[model samples]
Target: METRLLEPMESLISAFVLITFLQTALGAQEFYRQPTHESAVQGSSIVLRCIIKNRDGTVQWTHGGFGLGTERNLPGYDRYTMIGNTNSIDVDGNSIEEYSLKIDNLQLIDDTNYTCQVSPGDSDEGIISNMATVTVLVPPSPPILSGKVTIPVTLEKPTNVTCDALNGKPKAQITWKKDDVRIMENTYELTTTQPDGKRVDTRGIVTITAQPSDAGKKIECGAWNMALKEGEPLWTQATLDVQYAPKLTLTHSNPDRTIREVDEVKFTCSGEANPFQITWRWYRNGELQADVNGYQYTIPRITRDFHGQIIRCEAENSVGTTAVEHSLNILYGPKFKGDPAHVSVDQGERAELVCEAEGNPTAEITWRRQNKYSVLHTGSIYVIPSVREGMFGVYTCTATVLGFHEISRDIYVTENGPPQITSDATQYASIGDRAMIQCLSISSPKPIFVWSRNSQPIDYASSGRFSAPEEGLPFGGKSSLQILDVQEEDFGIYNCTVINTKGSATLMIKLEKSEEVQMAVIIGSAVGGVAVIFIIVIACIIYYKCRHSDNESYAETDSNTEIKKRDKNESPSEMTKSTLMDQWRQDYNYRYSAEFDDVDAKVGNTSGQYVCYDTERYGTMPTNHTNGHLYGEGVDDLGPLNRFENSYSTGYIPSTFRSPSRTDFTSGRVSANELASGRTSVNDFTSGRVSATDFTSGRVSTTDFSGRASADLVEPFRLPTADNTTSKLATNV
Candidate 1:
């Protein structure tokens, strides 16, 4: 098959060589012109040309050894036809014959080499010309891509992505690119024969190691062939979804400001991640705090201990994890770093006191006298140029931090080394228990301690309860007040004064109750308070029910007192007014004073004078008396004779009641108000609704209303109170 396919190509080359040699050996002009190549797209028309000296013999065209006769159209290839019969003049005055092939509706099968053959009678042998190639290009389909639509971060492996171009003539050449840049490594192409066996398909593959930076990038699969236009290739692309883990960066708040105790600080974590649903974790000094699904971490109260601590923030997504760290810088208050300084000097000499302190932002030092808070010097050292008798006192040194706490220490400037109380001597104890009060004094000579209570020395022998114990120590001495069977009187401000040859020192020791005793006292007080409140509430409820009860009690008949009754002519209010007016008139200028003096005459002579001899169920009621006058009344007791029974009517004289004449023997005048009326006001004297003017006008207000009364001959009215305590009114003038 190979030999048969090459026979036409070999014969065409031999004919081309013979024509060239004959022209060169004979030194004669060429008879034929070589055909130039012709190109066209598939399904389009193309023309192939052949030129010679003259039109003297028959001309024909052949493709690959198959001949097309002198007829214009070919046998099976209707698209192939011969053209050109006239001559086209050259630079020389020579005639030329041309035979060109015209193909219409060109297809891929028409792509082959063609040559021309001529026969000029018998004298000139038949000749075949050199071959001219006819190329027909068919464009392949647009590139189709498959594999790895999204790539994840893979450190141990690589991703394989593929692209294909199907059934292209001169099989398409395929390649891969990332975001318009070509990829060279781990890339290859494949070619497969198509079904018709005339064309092939091409496939391109690229293996890559995915990185976090490749997220949201583009991967391009391009196909190029002879059918494609120059500088333009068939391409397809996909935006890469590279699922990568997070790379975390941490930021904090208040970079310029200091973080003191009770200050707040905030930290935030952020990074680029493929899956945005990431989790964050916070750590301090390598200790994990908590796992947070968010990015912010807050320290509500930053302390000084966190100054050198390391803060870490970690972030994680579906793929991996990352972290960042920062060291904290915290600020705090100043403090005295070393032992308290002491300076000793003579009456007229120089001395210095140095104060050493430490703090964040550094501490400032100042010096002042003890008990005198004014700053005397500003520095870490205090120098006294001259010491005098007036300067023989304790000095104080203070270290201060701006906007923070300050500390102070005292420096003694004594003429001789004196005793100074150092430790707190306050103590706590319970009654019936033993107690010990301690006092530590610093001095060269041993200190002698004396415990006293309220400026009086304790009589140990008299009470047999107190004793003074002393101890000698390397620095100074320790003294304690010991009490056996401590009583309540022992808990007080007890003075512990230490005396030495150098100087004297005093300490006030307050003995207080212990926690258990104090708590017991509190509980006892609470229980007692509840009991008292319960008793008071019960008493009030009983009083309310008894005072408001409808049934009234009766009082003993007072035969030595005057009797009064309700008057039919007076309303309840006017009766109240007449009662008060009668007191004002009968006492000094009171007109009713004479009426009570001669009660027998008035009852015998006056018909409508008064009557109240009947004693019934309503004999007692609460009464009210203010400023020597009765005012209040009881509940409804209305009737024809004593409508105000069990009320102020007990003290009133009735105007409608016909007093019995001398024949009607009546008992001595009875003071019904004093004997039967009840009293319940917190104050002894209670006022009523009637004002001073109403009492004077005899038109007083009672029962929440106003009524007129007779001022000349008035009755004494008594008022009742809610508590119903018996109250008395004077019947004698």
Candidate 2:
């Protein structure tokens, strides 16, 4: 075998070896390149390269010993060309020449043996290059289905199917599949060549052992070749005709109808079977029942617990077993909807309670008072047409089904009481953010909600930015007024009233700008604060500078003393208005700056200086700035003042208290608009918080107001001490 292979190789190359010896002897020329074996897909192009060096010779091409004349384009073959590189490349002072064959639009017929013949120096002796065999790839045809088109099998038996792909240049790769899934197990392939000895064919066979579960499924064979489109193969398919055991379907006597307690229901298992005899089995919720081999099972007295059960029936034959299930949604006993209710209404108004239940059979309802045997009312709703004082007690509502259990819910009746609020009285949101003022109150019989702003009723039902929704709570009434988009006009006091059959209670809820706005204001104030402080410092310095000169002119000499003496007869009511600050500016400065509250002004150490406390901190204060008497509430927790042994004036009482501005006692803080609201009184300074005590101009409480001190403006003391002096404050109060 080896000698036979070497004989062919030696014969093809014998001429080349002889030419090499002759060329060495003559010292004439050499072969630089030789044609190489190649494979090309049909319909593409290919090149068989040949080159020679120092060639003073002619080159010719051959196909399987047939001569092909050396021409630019081959004779009789349009796709064949004998091309040469006439412009030779120099190699070590020797020119290298190329005489290569180029083939385009290749076909299977082009696959053959090729050779390049070179004759050196016009000698008759020819030198044959090594033989180069070319292969043209041809794709196989689409696969053909054969042998069982529909393979039939059962659990106990198996079957086979075959597919073939014929006439491929290179043998095709055959693959087996079942229902699009590649089947490798029990699948085999065979390959064979056609008589022509060029093209081959392949066949794939796959075995099927299908169960009842896989009946009516498809099987397939795929043929793949490198010459075909990428990732796509030709396919042939078959289906499975599987024979198995009986298939069962279950049906109940009550189809789409309610089966109540004590009602009879029968379930039947029916199916088609391959075998003559079929064994039946029944299971309830996966637990096998005692009776087997019965096609129908009957439940004579089905109970409520039987509802929502899965009853399955199985049919078995010699081949296999199949099962089906029926789910029971039988309606049964009655059950109450919610827990016992406690309803309350106002005296003499109709009171009612609804008792709801669900059951297959309609439930009967009745109402009765506790410890009283008589049935009060029937039906789902128990109504008390007119409830009086004595009617406030517990009533029982009973729901019953004809043959099942009876359920009861209690209704505790009571007269509604006055509503009391429990939610926050102040709600805040920024501009363009939602603001909800919720008023949650506790009373009996759900209450109604009413909203008002600045003594005017607010109608939330009208399609507007403000909306109030109705709410009903158990023994309470809850309501919220939603400000959809908070604007400048939205921030204010909102009166929320919770009313029922009982008395109504109104809560004062203030919706103001959120803390974000305060933070922005603080930042803005801080930015301008430095410049304002510089200006004030400069003004104070200049005032002191001028005051020093003025003191020299009006120093308590004999002439100034006589002027003071002239004013000595001026009574305590004698007053002089400010020269610089108009009433508005004075009021604005008092509200915003509140310099009297400046604990930093501790010259602050002394007691008699009345406190101007922050209402936000203390929670309450007097809005009435009349008579310049400051009243504060909950002042027992004064911080820095506690460090001093100060006696608060418990004696002072505000007379003729009035709020000239809308900033009343209820809204203790000053609004931005109120600062420039043109509201100003000469001595209208706000003290601290005041109670509802309307002092009828008599002597007020002698008890000294502790932290209630915001220093009085009219410091008309008998001894004529300064503004912050303890003795002067005590005397003036």
Candidate 3:
């Protein structure tokens, strides 16, 4: 408005000022400009920008009023970038007016107020930019729900339920629900931030008191955050548990609990319980029977031992234990009263057997053969009209009752017979040889045997040189008689008699000597006759003597009478008879020669006789030097010769003949009294009063024989008579 003098320098200054005003309005210095709030996920890149209208301004960045970077210096900065220098260009190819403070990885520490300040080169005063907030968005992870998880839980106890949310940028919220209904209770909550300050977590807990009505109900927990997606809340659930004791109810099909032996019996125990795990056990008569895992118990076979006994079943678990009992009434089968041993019956005889038994309920009796199922009879008494040999077997008597096992008894039947002889009735044997006669027979209970010869019994005590039957036989049904050495007397009738209670039988046997025995007797007689003749000749030549006339006959008569009396008493065995027979022969020969000499020679003379001396009696004739003739003296006594002469030769001879002495021949006047005093008797030799050596070599003194006479007379022999001859000479010769 002032029109003053117009100079050229002033006009140039006004046009230049107008151009400066236009440039100032077009480009001005400003710090960074951004939205009031910014959002980014953690671990993502973000920028805090400061925009300027002039590039000549100096820019600096600050976090919460603390310096982060300047135009020329960025002190102790990491993961942070400053961009847009003087030579930088934007997307539109113009100078870039934005100074960016960039963090490469966004974290929780990056989520705060950031400030940008700028001072233009022309002005020294700085201008501070508006504050901007960065938010790190994070979503919660899967939740954890914890509590008691089993069903039918124990009652009246405090059980805690909890829900938790983890790793959320903003703090999470947790809640509880029951059966889809929200729950309001004294819930405790806990919140926590991570050590790096990047995430936040929340946990919530609630306690529930369990009741019977809460059984089988569902409880749930939920976790949520602002950063969560739609319809994606974290959830977990649990159900309530209840507990109780067992209640038992037993069941059986039997209305009265009555059973029979061998019948199948079953029992069951079942009831309601809180926890269904149950174990069952069975007991009988107050004793444990079996353990059953389930609710049922069974017995396949019941016996009389279990009758009137109680059976109990118990069910047990962790909650409680309960039991139930059932009493059994049993009917038993038949049992034997008494058992009989095997029976023996004769063939073709009738048999009757009775089987006695006892039972609770009377049993039905039946009879059958063993291994043959066909029934033979239907009564306790079994009878056979006529028992045959084939009917001898085992017969079973079975007693049976309804609902019980069968009991059986077996009876065996056998047969018996009477004794019968089956051996020959005649036996032949040679004399002086062994012979046997066996009487075999068959009978039941065995038969007793007795052997008899003629009529006398032949037993161990009576038999001589023969063996009778022993008390028992080698073979069961037989007996034997063994004649060890048979004689003429043993050749007679033999009877083997067997007796039993049933009957008696006799087998007659004739024991005959063989023909060879008769021939042997004839031959022995002929040989003995020749021997006797030779003995008589030798005796006649040895003892020819003069005879005493009247005394000889009288002496012989007295000796013969004495021997006859002595022979009546003593009886000798066959061995003793043989010994006496040999002595009889010698005595007979001597006595006969003396008698022949008495017929020929006169008394005290050797003429008209055989002139033989007694050389056999005396060892030799003693020389008679005074008479110029041989005379007999010093005679050894041949003991007991004439006394036993006929006793052995025939049957038994009496003591008929006296022992002749040397004095009887030397002195004819000697009487029988003196001869008897010095003579040996037959009893002395046979009865062992004198030894055989004393008989054979006895000597009589010359003084006794000569009777103190002068040695002038020859002794006269005491002659023997016809009665003194040996009976063997009378018979065999």
Candidate 4:
């Protein structure tokens, strides 16, 4: 506007200056500019556009503000030119500017502000212009997790929830929750850089524990970038499930059972929870009875009361426990009764009494004998013998059942009457005769008979002939006393005692001799024969004195001589008679010779008298010759002699003599000298010349010469021998 200071060098300088000004203004517009975006994802390509504003101007490019042009203007700007476009200008390089800035990849420091400008002249005239700011931007991508999203969660267990955003522009924010409740907050973590130059975004772990109530509950994991909004949530959920089983138990009231007497009963119990199997057991006393799978129990026929009884049941499964119980009261009764009480025995004997009883347990039997001896037994019969008065007392048989009950009975034994006695002999007998005494008894009870003599029991052979018929018996006979020849020794009382239910008896006897009267007659006749012979001798002496009186003295001497001679002859006969008479007197002691003082009166005359006189009147003769002659004779003649001699010859005679006269005559007063010297021959006596003188000769006179002989004194006679006059005399006497 002032047109100021134009010179020759001014006028020419003025036109040059105007042209310099136009060139300066045009070159100032060709500088490079920085991009607007600063940051980029690590592996992505980026474009950094550095814009230049001068069109129709030479342009150059460089890094970190280094120039690519010199002071001298050159065509090297073609290397920095836009395609098909030379120097053309637009404001701030909106159009037709040299836009020559470029970047193949972006980095963090590339975010700084950059300037683009141009230089007007050579050497010291270059300048720079205003810069454009670049800022790199990145958006959030889907996050990835390292561990499981739907996790198996347990109570009281610590767990980690991880969210990794690979190569994220800004690190991500992570959280954890359970059922939408917040558990942990944004705990962002930066992981180490990747090989592709990108970074990892890591989140913190969420620690939590679950309880029993937390079983089957949900737990959650959540992630956010704020770059990724809430509507599209980064949260994951898992359900928690828990598993277990329950426990079981069982119970009972009575564990053991005992019973007394008669009562009723029941049993029961319960079981605990589980998948349980149960069983029940019942016991009587201490013994096991029944087992069942159910709870209720009952026992019928309960006869005994259960004393302190118990019953129990049990339940069991995978787990364990126990429960309460139920019990009962029971009773029972005694089982059996006793058998009958009795005794068995033979008809007339004693026996035993046995009592028996039986029960659940065996019963006891008590036996009492006569209320005295006592015995006990389980079961048996009692026995005894001889049913007598002693066995007649009380016998009790009692039985006790179960030691609690009893029954008894009384028994008695009885027998019949006493025994009897029978004998075989009459009431009386002579001494030395046989007699029998026997005992026979009859009773219901058999008797024992004891046979005794003189109060002492008799042995079988004590009596010469005594014997026992058989052993003692009831109907059978017993001992017998056979007194063979009863004597005064056997005269004592005899007893056959029958000992039985009844009592005893005896028989008495006396023994004596027969023929006392016959003995007396024999004594009288012997004394009478001596007296008659004496009378005859005295009478003959008187008659001779009367006839010789003239030679009185001679007559007296002669008569005296005759008397002496007669005395001599008669004395032998008289002495024999006297000896026999004395012997009879000594043996019998009976007074009978006084009645036979008359000899003729005792033996009267008969023709038999002469036979009696020769033998009987010569009683003092020797008998030695007679025995010798008789022994030599025939036995027929000896028979009558032996019979007659033995009949009257009391065996006191010597064996050498044949007659009793030998004993009587040898003791006679007759001298042996007189018998030898005297001569008294009276012969021719065998002729049939019957004269009074012959009949009445010598000492032969009788009480009546023809009177018959006494029937008691006379007996038939025979001569034993011619020399046997002595024995014949003995018989006649």
The models' CA-based lDDT, in order, is 0.59, 0.60, 0.57, 0.40
User: After TM-score superposition, what is the CA distance of residue 695 in candidate 1 from its true location, in Å?
Assistant: 99
How many clashes does the backbone of model 4 have?
53
Best by TM-score: 2
Model 1, 1-733: lDDT tens digits are 9999999999999999996675444332235576767777789898877776644467888887788788766667778887777647555545577777888999877888888877763334566678888877777788887744554444434766778888888788887889889898898888898886757888887887776677778888888778778869888887666565677888888877767776898999888876777878888999888654478889888887788799998888765677899988777788786665455444577878789887676889998866465788999988888876456445678889887879987654433345666433445677889877766555544568787888998888897878877766433566767889988877888887778876687777678766554778999999997997698568556644543341143233633211112221234355546554544333322322212321111111011111222111111111111111111112221123334333423334332222222111122222112111233221111112111232233222222111222332222332222121111222111
Query: Once superposed on the true structure, which residue ranges of model 1 sit more than 4 Å away at CA?
Result: 1-31, 87-95, 120-122, 147-156, 195-198, 241-733
User: Which segments of model 2 are wrong by more than 4 Å?
Assistant: 1-245, 249-323, 329-333, 340-352, 359-362, 383-393, 402-405, 412-418, 422-440, 444-472, 477-504, 507-733
Model 4 over residues 212-264: C-alpha lDDT tens digits?
78765666655555345455646656665432222223332333644434433
Alpha-carbon deviation at 335 in model 2, angstroms: 2.4
Ranking of all candidate structures by their TM-score, best first: 2, 1, 3, 4
lDDT (Cα, 0-100) at 433 in candidate 3 = 84
CA RMSD for every model?
Answer: 38.0, 26.4, 44.6, 59.6
Whole-model lDDT, model 3: 0.57
Cα TM-score of candidate 3? 0.28
Ranking by lDDT: 2, 1, 3, 4
Which segments of candidate 4 are over 4 A away from where they belong? 1-17, 23-141, 180-198, 213-733
Q: Quote the RMSD, in angstroms, for model 2.
A: 26.4
Which parts of model 3 are misplaced by more than 4 Å? 1-28, 31-35, 64-66, 70-79, 82-96, 148-158, 184-188, 192-200, 213-218, 238-733
Better of 1 and 4 by TM-score: 1
